[model samples]
Target: MIEIRGLTKSFHKHKVLDQIDLTIRKGDIVAVIGSSGAGKSTLLRSINLLEVPDAGTIRLDQLQVDFARKTKADVLELRKSTAMVFQQFNLFRQKTALENVMEGLIVVRKVPKEEARKIAARHLAGVGLSDRMHHYPKQLSGGQQQRVGIARALAMQPKILLFDEPTSALDPELVGEVLDTIRKAAEAGNTMLLVSHEMSFVRKVATRVLFLDQGVIVEDGTPEEVFSRPKSERTKQFLANYYRDQEPEFTI
Candidate 1:
């Protein structure tokens, strides 16, 4: 289980996160949904220390870090338990898909080079990128590169996988493939926390959903509850606009 307590953050004197308390049970696929500037990305990033919290305590199983007093070693230890996939497909342009996935394993984890290769290959294949393993990021489609990013994170076997708008950078036609890859990962029982605008996908795969407004999680419940019976007015307004253009799975 992952426990986060009293998490808070500010940017240039503007608070981006309030004192947030969240608990994620194992195998929970939690999806955070909110309008832009609702602090969705910040919340996900803070978990892996990508955006350090002003005050918080995060415990991932046996590992714990108090942001107020955490050292570099504590930061690294916390990071070791989680892996993040960014929206922009942050792969190395100079490396092949396989190499990008193997870099962390062989360098950070100190796995043998041959062993890293095998592991990377398996994950790349898992994301349906086996044929593109040797292709560089520039050579692959946006969706393919994102899959490589996913594969790299999967190769870490971290206790939790963090996704920050993983499909936002993709073209509309390419979104489904990346979402499919994530669904497959979920089926494999990888605990995940994601910030996404894909309402339909979130409703379909998320075991739990959070609605954030003004840096606070105002609603948290099963997908059915949040989408169909949201208790917060802000959540209702947000989903109304979101589903206005499509066939809504959510009742505004």
Candidate 2:
């Protein structure tokens, strides 16, 4: 389980997150939705200690994050428990898909190279990239590269997975394939915290949804509740523009 309390973060003099509190149970798929600059991505990164919270407590299972006394070792351990996947596929150019996935296990976890290869192959297959294991990032399409990224995270066996706009960088036609891979991961009961603009995907997979505006959570509820009958005016306006292009008219 992941628990966060009194989370706050700032950049220079500008506040990006303000006294945020949330709890995510194991195997829950929680989606954070908002307009640009709403601090959704910052909040996800903060959970993994990628962005230090100015004041907050983050606990993942037995591990605790002390933002006040955050050390390099603390950050490393937190990162191991929480793997992050970005919008841009950040695969090493020189490494093959399999090698890319195996890198963390071999380097960080100190697994034997052979054992890491086996694990990497299994994760790649899980993401439907087994056939492309030998391909380099440059040789694969955008969606395939993102699949390798997913495999790399899975190879770490993280307790929590954080996705920051995973499909934002993909072509429209390729977005479905990447989201489909994530849907499978969700079905497998991984604890996921996703920052995404894909409302349909959120509606389909999120056990809970958070709507943020101006660095604070304005709405928090089950996906059905938030999407169908939002309580806050901020949330209603946000969804109004968000579902503007969709058919059937988003309504309660």
Candidate 3:
């Protein structure tokens, strides 16, 4: 399990995240949804220490770190337990899909080259990229590149996977492929925290959904509850605007 307590972050005196506390149990696929600038990405980034919390305690299983006083080693140890798949599919331009997946294993995890190659190839194939494994990121479509990003994260086998708007950069036609790959990962029981605007996908996959607004989680519950009977006015208003342009799976 992962526990966060009093997580707070500020940028030039403006608070981006404020005194947030949450817990993610094993095998829980938690989806965070909110309007733009609602701190969803910040929340995910903070858990992985990409955006260090100004004040907080993050506990991953038996490991804990106090962000206010954590040393570099503490930071590294925390990072080892989490991996992030970004929206932009941040693969090295010059590296092939297999090399991108292997990079972390070979460099950070200190796995032998041959072993890393085998593991990377397996994960690339898991994301349906076996034939494209030898292709560079630029040569792959958006969906394919994002699948590689997912593969690289899965290869890490971290305690929890973090996805920050993983489908936002994909074209509408390409979105489903990446979403399908993520769904497969979820079914395989990888603990995940996803920030996404794909409400249909969120409703289908999330064990729990959180509605974050202005640096706070305003609503938290099952997809059926939050999407159907949201208690917070802010959540209702947000979802109203969100579903106006698209068909919501649940009545808003």
Expressed as tens digits, the lDDT of each residue in 151-224 for candidate 2 is: 89878988999999999999999999999999998998889999999999999999999998888999999999
- lDDT per model vs. reference: 0.95, 0.92, 0.94
The alpha-carbon RMSD values of the candidates against the true structure, listed in the order shown, are 2.6, 2.4, 2.5
lDDT of 1 by residue, 1-252 (tens): 999999999999889999999999999999999989989999999998889999999998888899999999988888888999999999999999999999999988999999999999999999998899989999999999999999999999999999999999999999999999999999999999989999999999999999988889999999999999999888899988877878756787
* Candidate 2 C-alpha error for residue 251, in Å: 18
Model 3 — TM-score against the truth?
0.97
lDDT at 141, model 1: 97
The CA lDDT at 159 in model 1 is 93
Q: Estimate, for each residue in 93-171, the C-alpha lDDT of model 3 and write its tens digit.
A: 9899999999999998999999999999999999999999899999999999999999999999999999999999999
Against the true structure, candidate 1 has what lDDT? 0.95
lDDT of the structure predicted as candidate 3: 0.94
Model 3 lDDT-worst window of ten: 243-252
